[model samples]
Target: MDHREIIQILNEKKKICLLIDASKYATILTNDSFKFEECLRIISKLTSDLRIINKILNKKSPKDKITSLTNILLQLYGCMLALTNGDVSQENSNDKNNIESNSIKFVKGKYGKPLLESSMPIKFSMTTDKLFSSMFLTKGLEDTEVGIDVANVINYCGSNCIDLFRDIFTEQEFNYLSTSPNATTELQKARLFTKYWSFKESYSKYTGEGLNCAFQKVNFGELTIEDDTTIKTYDLHDDIGLVLNFYSKWIDSNRVLTVCYKCSNDHKDNYIVHKRIDLRDVLNYLNGADIFD
Candidate 1:
């Protein structure tokens, strides 16, 4: 489907749905081609709300590249989809004016954390695999951040990579993985490896450091979240107030999906998590239900 068609589908849902599927492209360059095309299609569909973005794109502004511009468009569409009901066409003169007046500029923060202008209250986060990208947006949620990451565990480490990462594991985590009967096989090692990688990526996204933070210093196995329970304190940078929560589903015996969210409030004490088995299933769930539903 074209980008506008996708936006219409999303707008009809009245919620944000960040879809990531990497199987379509071969590498980052090719992935950019596909993603940029999707962005153009989305902007075309958003003709009513494309003033600032279109101006930048049309003028070929030096401050941003075509790829960054495309990312901004995707983020804006996601933010709009999340904040408004299906009636986004009913323009808010204030937001429209903000768009036109340069009151809300899309700019990159340290380590490339894309930020909507400080004046704008919207918050967003995104992550990618070799071929797919995922993004999330929320309104008026304090210290709100959303991170989505996909990794091929086998690709990061050879057969022994899990062992390498395991060396850094906390005692509690090490005892579980090392002694668990499942770790005897290569496939199990790969699964554990991906889980750790996803956790670190999610944590990095939480800190807004991306890859600039030291992964070795942060151990994923030490952190755990049980159903209906949340842990508030963990060893992380002082500047970051992060609540890490994740959902994982096995796509196959070999592939998996893990999503992480960062929030300022204590969601763990009262939050309910919903999960799906695959990308298409996630799309269907998010599209069909209200956030509270």
Candidate 2:
């Protein structure tokens, strides 16, 4: 979809999962299809903050490339919020009149979770594998939480990943993998192990605990995989009064994606909408398209 069309959906739904192909971005940079100077020019029009612009421009490494893409998307998302009269930083409350002030800034939460510098309820989390990356964004209450993780099966399937990461899974989980019919083959075991690992990572990310959380004790309930399907549903264990939902699926033959969040029971059906996006559209938006119209 076009940039404005995507913004319209985000305006209506207030949450979206953007699936991005890292290869496309890599092509753009390596082919010199989009000059670095031109990128800076486009970004400079969005914000006069030279420090932020310079930092983004210096993202040359593989990890830095993903961060750079995230920075661009956040800036565009901030613009959408401004057009839709959504929450924005107090200093930029007048951004409607000065579009350049729409650039986004981030600060660390108590546990080092990246949060918007503004007190706005805008929340986002990102995950990247070798080929693709995904970002989950939502505008909700302060208590809202969302997390995502993606992994390539081939990366783990080559080795005995289950044994290497055995400490992360509970005894029950390990037994399930050992006895389940689905784990009869090495490849099957790898996919199942990667799926469980991604789920645990998603939950840890959701809790803002990251690697500090005790994953083995965080029971994921019963994950019965009778067949190879894209999407699977299961009842997630809950907190005191909070209900958390989880969604996972195979993005393709080799890649798996997982998302965890807090929302109403019924909200799982539509709480977070997924949209596969082209980096070109995002670049166009960053290049100064009128997302409001």
Candidate 3:
């Protein structure tokens, strides 16, 4: 479905898809015809918040600044579309650059988890790898937070990958990656390592720990595979009152995607709905075209 349809679903259900593509963004950034200043101007208009615009502009590299701006633009635009019930005419109106300043505020958790300062109960998490970026946004989930991560195992399948990860994994997790019967082949071990690492990262993000939480301390030794759909739940030793429900899948043979969120203490099933957003459509919308119309 198109972004308009997805925004409608987000407005009604408070959950949208897992965004999993960034090639379009890379192309636009790398294309010789693409004007960096022009792209920056569009991002400024879309966000309309000097705080965010200045943050993106202060990055060291042009690519870094543009990429940061683009990602934040997508997030702010998505939140705006949902909050305004898809009435985005202001996005293209003469005062578009003031939209965010007038309507919304962006905040962050203590550990840098981005949050939208809104009356509605909305939580979003985003992560980016080399080729793709993933975002999870949902609304009206009382007392629950979400975190997402994507990793490419192929990059870690090098000769010293096991050695590289030796310090990151706990003893049991190391055994699982190095000598467990479940991971006999080199590629198998790499995939297993990716899963463990992504789980730790997403969990930390969920807790607003960011990189402060030591990966070695977060052990997944007791992690067990569930019966269906590769869904798994792990109880955090650090917090007895919260449960981590993870929905993980292989977007491809070499790439793994994970979404982590909290569930009730009783272990109720909470499944996340995922849809891939079209980067081209997002690009078009950023250019002041109403894809919904």
User: For model 2, how does the per-residue alpha-carbon lDDT over 1-293 read when each residue is reduced to its tens digit?
Assistant: 54444445555565677777756456545556345456656666655557656666576674465556555554454444434443333543333334445555556677877666555567767777654668777664346877888866777744456667778888888778667776777777778777887788987888788999788866665464322233334334453344566677777887777787776433335335677876566655555453212
lDDT at 166, model 2: 74
What is the overall TM-score of model 3 with all chains considered together?
0.78
List all candidate RMSDs to the true structure. Answer: 9.1, 5.5, 4.7
Write down the TM-score of every candidate.
0.57, 0.76, 0.78
Clashing pairs in 2: none
Q: Model 1, 27-120: lDDT tens per residue?
A: 3323456544544444444434455456546634332334344344445545543433334343531143334333334566767766766543
Which residue pairs of candidate 3 clash? 17-275, 18-275
Off by over 4 Å in 1: 1-17, 22-73, 83-104, 118-120, 166-168, 216-243, 250-255, 263-293
The TM-score that candidate 1 achieves is 0.57
Ordering by lDDT: 3, 2, 1
Evaluated with lDDT, which candidate comes out highest? 3
Record all residue pairs in model 1 with backbone atoms less than 3 Å apart, i.e. clashing.
none
Give residue 115's lDDT in candidate 3 (0 to 100): 83
Top TM-score model: 3
- Which ranges of candidate 2 are over 4 A from the true structure? 11-14, 31-34, 40-83, 86-99, 157-159, 224-242, 265-272, 289-293
